[model samples]
Target: FNPKLRELILAGKTQTLSPKENELLKMLAEHKNDLLPRERALKKIWGSDTYFNGRSMDVYIAKLRKYLKEDSNIEIVNIHGNGFRLVAP
Candidate 1:
């Protein structure tokens, strides 16, 4: 792993995270304030877009939100029927 990535992982204070949670946070950090499409997350992380997978993604999203709650400027906003945006200010 790159030293910078290691530092970021350490700074996040994440000892361990589920696969979905780790991928979600990685994408969010990559996009930052940009929109992160739901379909993209589903396809990339879960590898499918079935109803069950969608629900699982929701669970992961909720978990990420909880983990990032300490940063007031960071938020995961749902763009009803569209996607989510990880806003950082």
Candidate 2:
């Protein structure tokens, strides 16, 4: 994934992501194998972690999952009431 280009090259296919998606993915990549607090991501990317913003972040998470699904070894695991972690090689 290239943050500057907002490009994800998966399985030899290229996918372009939205600005927010790029930001969120970049943040997750930074925190790969570590906990990325939901509040932290919301505030950093969405500017605030309101109910609506939290819900919006969820949607983005699902989208990110779709984009990353081509890779069987990578996962965005939910920490259930805490945060998320990017599990990857």
Q: Judged by lDDT, which candidate is best?
A: 2
For 1-89, candidate 1 gives per-residue lDDT tens digits of: 12234222333564456655777778877778888888888788778445554756788888778767766767899888878888887
Candidate 2, which segments miss by more than 4 Å at Cα?
A: 48-52
Cα-based lDDT at residue 20, candidate 1:
56
List clashing residue pairs in candidate 1.
none
- Tell me the tens digit of each residue's lDDT in model 2 across 1-89: 99999999999999999999999999999999999999898888878435464766788999999989999899899999988899999
Q: What's the TM-score of each model vs. the native?
A: 0.75, 0.92
Q: By TM-score, who's the top model here?
A: 2
lDDT against the true structure, per candidate, is: 0.71, 0.90
C-alpha RMSD values across all candidates: 3.7, 1.7
